[model samples]
Target: MSFLQLLIIAIVQGVTEFLPISSSGHLILIPKLMDFPDQGPLIDVAVHVGTLAAIVSYFWRDVWGLARGGFASVGIGTAPAERRLFWYIMAGTVPAVLVGLFLKTGGYLEGFRSTTLVAINLIVYGVLLGIADRFGAQRKSFEELTLKDAVIVGLAQALALIPGTSRSGVTMTAARFLGYSRFESARFSFLLSIPAIAGAGLLAVLDLADASARMQSDAITAGALTFVAAILTMVFLMNFLKRASMMVFVVYRVAMGVALLLFFA
Candidate 1:
């Protein structure tokens, strides 16, 4: 890919990956609209790595805590909040993993990338997020998270297998609906993403191996740029959610969805 193409792809992947906008949807639409060549497997893997690195870097403290807590909990038992949170993240990942495995095995996920389906989901889930944010009790924080919360959020994440459903968006919506505060809801969502993103990257790596995919000439440059963009976007989004509601994202999703439908229709 050209430098300009990489720049655009990096920006879209970085922003939408965390902003409650669908990264997969944007990646599909933007390239089509701009008439760019297919990004191919190497670029896909690079961007995935970039976003994964961003999330991991941003949440390193939590990642460390989870690692230590998980190991210790295996022996002494999981009694501390950090240890419990570790387990909670694991619990939250199960539903999505199971659902993703099923979809992959059945070759169902690729077909769901239809523009019409993406447009419909964009509007539908946008409204769902708005409703949850507007009416949710907003009384809970990360410290107060429970097993039930994780499972419900995890189940919601399963729906995100569909293009435009947005893994972050659905999980945050579920967390909000379960009464978590906006920032804390987002925190949990981001934390939950670590395993999910890692799993996805691993799958992509295996696919690359199977296909004997070769890296683009500028793959390193593209990956580095994407990583920088993703990290900045991740930081900005986490801070933004701390003070704002999901209303802006809701409006954006709905508007984009409508535009997409009109254009495609």
Candidate 2:
């Protein structure tokens, strides 16, 4: 890819990664529709690491608390908010990590055509989201999230491996359905993403090492650019998420899905 393509891909990765629209889905569908190579496995990891840095920077306070809480829970130290949420985030991540391992290595996420399935899921999930908010306007905040709810949300997150299911969207939707407020649901979704994305990125690093023996310097540089883009995306999404309406994202997802379907057809 040219520097311009690298920059554009990074920007798109950063923005769409946080949006309710599926980032991974976009990585697949956008390339096919626009006639570009699907970004390589190593690049996926690199971009994820960039996003991880962004989330950690933005939510350092929460990260500290979760760390303190996680430590304390193990009888090491004391931090209050750190207790359940720390563990809950960990619990929520387990299913996705497991599923990701199997699918990533088992060839489950291959075939560019799966993006069509993703687009379909995006449309269907968008409708479900509207119905969910209409009927399940939650008054409870993230503070009220239970271990059970966290686990369920995590499971929903695991299903986001499907092209258009969207990790953030699915997790937020599930949280809302379980009685969490929109802001809380959104916050928790982002929080949960930290570990999941980080884990994925770490895996990519290993793959990149092997690829480095065969891949050119330019490929590595491109991946670095993608990583930078992911970081910017995480920053923009987290802040905008605080104020953006679900309606906007819902409309976008539906429109993107429809566009993909038509274009592919």
Candidate 3:
């Protein structure tokens, strides 16, 4: 890929990955719309690493707490609340991992890559997010998270395996419906992405053993650019949620979905 194409891909992946907008949907549409070459598994893995680093950096405190809690759960420390939160995150990741594996192994993942499906899901889930945000209670804090709620959110996240269902969007929607504030909801969603993104990057890496030197160089550049963009985006989103509703994202998703459908039609 040319530098311009690489730059655009990194920006798109970084910006959309954490937003309610669907990164996978946008990535799928990029080549189709712009006639750029497909960025293969190497790029995918690189971008995943970038976004994963962004999440980790943005949530370092929570990550550290989870680490201590995880060790403590096995009798090493004394972080009861942290231990509970750690397990809750683990519980929330199971459904998505299983469903993703099933889709990959069955060769069913590619079937959902069409723009039409992405467009439909964009509008559908966008509206659902709007509805949940507008009507659901938002008094609960992150500390109030429970196992049942985590599982429910996990199940919602599995739906994001579809092209435009948006892992972050669906998880936030589930949390909204369960009465979490928008900020807390987004926090949990982002934290839950750790294992999911790492698993995906590892799987993508399995296909990279034979990557050429040039490809490896490109991957590193892509990863670095994506990391920069992703960290900035994460900071913006976290701060935005502190004082704003999700209606802007809802409007954006709906508008983009409608435009895609019209253009494709």
The lowest-lDDT stretch of 10 consecutive residues in candidate 3 is: 204-213
Worst 10 residues of 1 by lDDT: 210-219
Query: Candidate 1: which stretches are off by over 4 Å?
Result: 40-42, 76-79, 211-213, 216-222
**TM-scores for every candidate against the unseen true structure:** 0.92, 0.89, 0.96
The 0-to-1 C-alpha lDDT of every candidate, in the order given, reads: 0.83, 0.75, 0.90
Per-residue lDDT of candidate 2, residues 1-265 (tens digit): 5566556666666777777777777766656766777666566556656666767777788788888888899899877677988888899999999999899888876753376797798898887776665566668776776889889999999988777887888888898888777777877888999888888877776776677554445445655665566666666665674676578888888998898788777
RMSD of 2: 2.4
**Reference-based TM-score, model 3:** 0.96
Q: In model 3, which residue pairs have backbone atoms overlapping below 3 Å? A: none
Model 1, C-alpha of 217: deviation from truth (Å): 5.7
Clashes of each: 0, 3, 0
Residue range 30-121, candidate 3, lDDT tens digits = 89999998786568668878899999998999899989889998999899999999999899999999998999899898798799999999
Poorest 10 consecutive residues of model 2 by lDDT? 212-221
> Per-residue alpha-carbon lDDT of model 1 for 237-265, expressed as tens digits?
88898788899999999999999999999
Please give the lDDT score for candidate 2. 0.75
